[model samples]
Target: MRLAGNLLLAVLVLAALAIAATYWRAGQREAAARAAYPPLGQILDVGGVQVHAHVTGAGPDIVLIHGAGGSLRDFTFDLAARLSDRYRVIAFDRPGHGHTDAADTAGRRFDAPRQQAALLQAAARQLDIARPLVVGHSFGGSVALAWALEQPGDTAGVVLLAGATMPWPGTLNASYRINSSLLGGALVVPAITAWVPLPYARQVLAGIFAPQPMPESYPAEFGLPMALRRGLLRANARQVNGLRPHVVEMSGDYPGLEIPVELLHGDADEIVPLHVHSGPLSALLPDAVLTVLPGVGHMPHHAMPDHVTAAVDRVAERAGLR
Candidate 1:
């Protein structure tokens, strides 16, 4: 009986040690991530939330919103910088991603694309951005659509790069499901944040851009560590897991939109299937155009920048910004 009790005590001690270790490591990693990828833009206070906006170049305005688990760095890596030459580019770190704080004081998760669009529009107004061409990738695409639907007069045009438009059929990945839950966010998130290595993060990114080579400089430039921060990880999971229902509701509103939309998607994109999103989206809008790359993957902005650039240029012309 004593031996059994001792064994139980040992198990309790080990579990306690593991929890303590995870907490300590999580703190360390969070600090390191902040130091490694310091905000590259000005933090503007919009309502109660803080938004990070990177503005550059001088021409007609172009706002860029990145996908899930991404920051303005995703655009700055290449697309935003390149576009800046021809347009005034404003890349935003969406609420709950990168340095942007979720402004919902009620502590409600800022997962709905409409909510995100409202926040981003408020931020753009503060920066004096008016009727800019908006570009959204992946999850950002959903936000762009919402922006156009909610305030059609304010958006000049839209460019969707492998945008997530339609309500996808399957459940989110197991990791997103787990981390989105209260218990998982409280426990599993911290554990992953604490113990996940850079290579593992890279592996996940590679999968996102599968069938296409990850740009060699992407890991460093895109700030992988920022995405792994505990708060951001939980926020991303919540947004991703809750996205489908929101998309379903939003998809019905697309037919009423009047703004010009140019969608560039890869036929090989497994992340956001081409047939499911851009394909149907084109048929829904009166002025929408869809371009399918023959053998590209999800990261078309990186894999085929020239095509993306041309699409943006076409939108600019259509919007009379050219």
Candidate 2:
């Protein structure tokens, strides 16, 4: 009995040491990420939260909101620069994902699309962005909808690039289901950030851009290492894991939004299935125009920038902002 107890204690001590080492490694990796890739834009103070805003070009304003698990660098990669000559483009790091601070509210409210919109909207006000056409991709699409829904008068229009609008029928993937849980968040996430190699990001990116070939410059330019940080991993997991309820609530208020919305979704997108999201969303919005890309995947913006910009142009014309 005494020998058995000693063996159990030894195993426990080894396990605890391993866990501590994992956390320490996580902190070191996060620090390295921050040090290597500093914020590429100004970090604005928006009502107590720090917002990272990258502004370029000069014309009617256009706000670019990136999807889940990414920073504003996603836009800075190419689209923002492509549109810069035609419009004053402003790409933002959403709360808790990039450099933007999460909402201080309880219940992890930062995951709520409304909360994210409100925070980014305040930052827009600070920049004096006048009636800008808002563009959101993937998860960011929900934020764009929330922006238009919350403050229609302040928005010129909206463009959703494969937006996750309507609530889906089933549960999210196991990673989101697990990581979003309270126990997984507290225990599993730190281990992930610490031990997971940054190169593994490519495997995940592969799923996001299945039918379409991922651009060679995408991974490093998107700041994948920074996203692998513990805080970001937790924030993204929680946001996506708990997203369905927020979308359901937002869908109820969709009828009240009067702004023109341009939607561009790829038919082949498995990430946020087109039939499940944009297909049903088009029926709800009174002035929504959806352009289905025949063979493109989840990232319509990256796969088809011309079509995406054309939609933005249409919205600008319709909104009388051009």
Candidate 3:
């Protein structure tokens, strides 16, 4: 009896240690991430959430939306530099990602489409972005699609980079979904992530950009501030949780898209799975043109920027901008 009691006590102690260790590590990592990526500019209040955004260049207006768990920097840093020369490039953090305020629920807060469309409309009004071409990556791609579908004739064009336009695959099980929330997003997750330095999470993100090395600035670009980490996680969780419903809601109307659309996808994409997403999305948009990169992964903009730029230019030409 004494041995059994001792064994139970040991397990409790070990569990306590594990939790403590996790908490400590999360704090350390969050600090590192924040220190690494300093905020670049002021925040803009849009639809109840304070969003981080940057704008540059001139001529036609273009908005770049980063994927789930990504920030405005993802697009603004490299791609924006190249595109901003001719087009006014605007990259804004979504409701939950980057510097955006995580003040609401996934479903009720800013549903992907509503938030995106409203944001574009608001940012356009605030920044004087007019009939801009919208470009989005991963989940951001879906928001772009949703916005286009919602407004019909309002948008000038859309560029979906490895977009998660269709319903998500079943492989994204419960645990993955939970971790996407608990480990990667929101206040609690970011708080934990801040200290933990989740290598697996980093690996998964890196894999999407496979055949390409992880960006040197990935941690800074993606890691949320400790204060905002949980908000990021919650927002990301809401994004995936409502993904299927959003896909279902938008699929029926995709065929009706009147704006010019271009889809750039890496044939080797593993994260959102190209065949499941881009395949059907290309078929759905009547005016959509598809470009497939053989060796690239999900982040085609980063992996194949030249090709991506050409595609964007093509869209611009079609829109009569170039």
Candidate 4:
């Protein structure tokens, strides 16, 4: 009996050490990535939160909101130069992502749509942008839609890229909930950052991208930046189980939207699943125009910029913004 007890004790000790070591590695990876891609200049304070935003171009205002686990740089770093010539494009690190304040204590709201609406109202007021056209990708799409609904008369239009407008199937998994937990957050997240390292995190993200190679800068842009990771994790926690309540609350509001709306979704998208979103959302909205791309994935905007850009042009023309 004594020998058996000793063996069990040893096994427990080993398991605990192994778990600690695993977290340590994750933390290391996160640190390295953060050091590699330091923040670029210019941040804006909207509603007491410091939001990192890049503004360029010279025509009507256009706000680009990136998806879950992304930064403002996701849209602006590579694509801004292209659109700057024709429009005043502004992309911001949404609250709890990128260089923006991780916690929006002032607002005390975690739902994507509410935060998005508040951000747009604050941004427009701060920047003096009048009824700017908005574009949101994936999670950002929900934000764009929410903002338009909240301020219907003030919006020129909106474009959604693989957005989660309608409630999608799938319950929140345990892992997602744990990662978002505040009690576990401080310990688990910091430990993961200190040990596992960015390369490994990049590999994990790669699995989600499917056929396309993960963007060369994904680690630096998403994984390595500890701040971005922290913000993303917090946002995820706040909306655990997929923000279903908010989605439900806002569902009936879609059909009443008065502004021009367009949705672009990939037929092959697995994350948000085209059936749950693009299919139903397109049908519900009073005047939504959806462009379904064959053989494409969730990140179609990033994967196929030219095609997405052309669609944006069409939306602009339809909205009479051109």
Q: Please, what are the lDDT tens digits per residue for candidate 4 over residues 181-210?
A: 776676666565555455676676776566
Candidate 3 per-residue lDDT over residues 173-196, each given as its tens digit: 563366455444433454455454
The whole-model lDDT of each prediction reads: 0.90, 0.88, 0.74, 0.73
The true-versus-predicted C-alpha distance at residue 73 of model 1, in Å, is 0.5
Candidate rank order under lDDT: 1, 2, 3, 4
Cα lDDT for residue 297, model 1?
91
Question: Per-prediction TM-score, please?
Answer: 0.97, 0.96, 0.83, 0.85
Writing each residue's lDDT as its tens digit, candidate 1 over 224-315 gives 98888888988888888889999899988888888899999999998899999999889998899999998999999999999998999999
* Sliding window of 10 residues with minimal summed lDDT for model 4: 222-231
Error of 1 at 33 (Å): 1.0
Which candidate, 1 or 3, has the higher lDDT?
1
Order the numbered candidates by TM-score, best leading: 1, 2, 4, 3
**Candidate 3 residue spans exceeding 4 A from truth:** 1-28, 104-108, 180-195, 198-202, 215-228
Report model 4's TM-score to 2 decimal places. 0.85
Model 4 CA deviation exceeding 4 Å by range: 1-35, 105-110, 221-223, 240-242
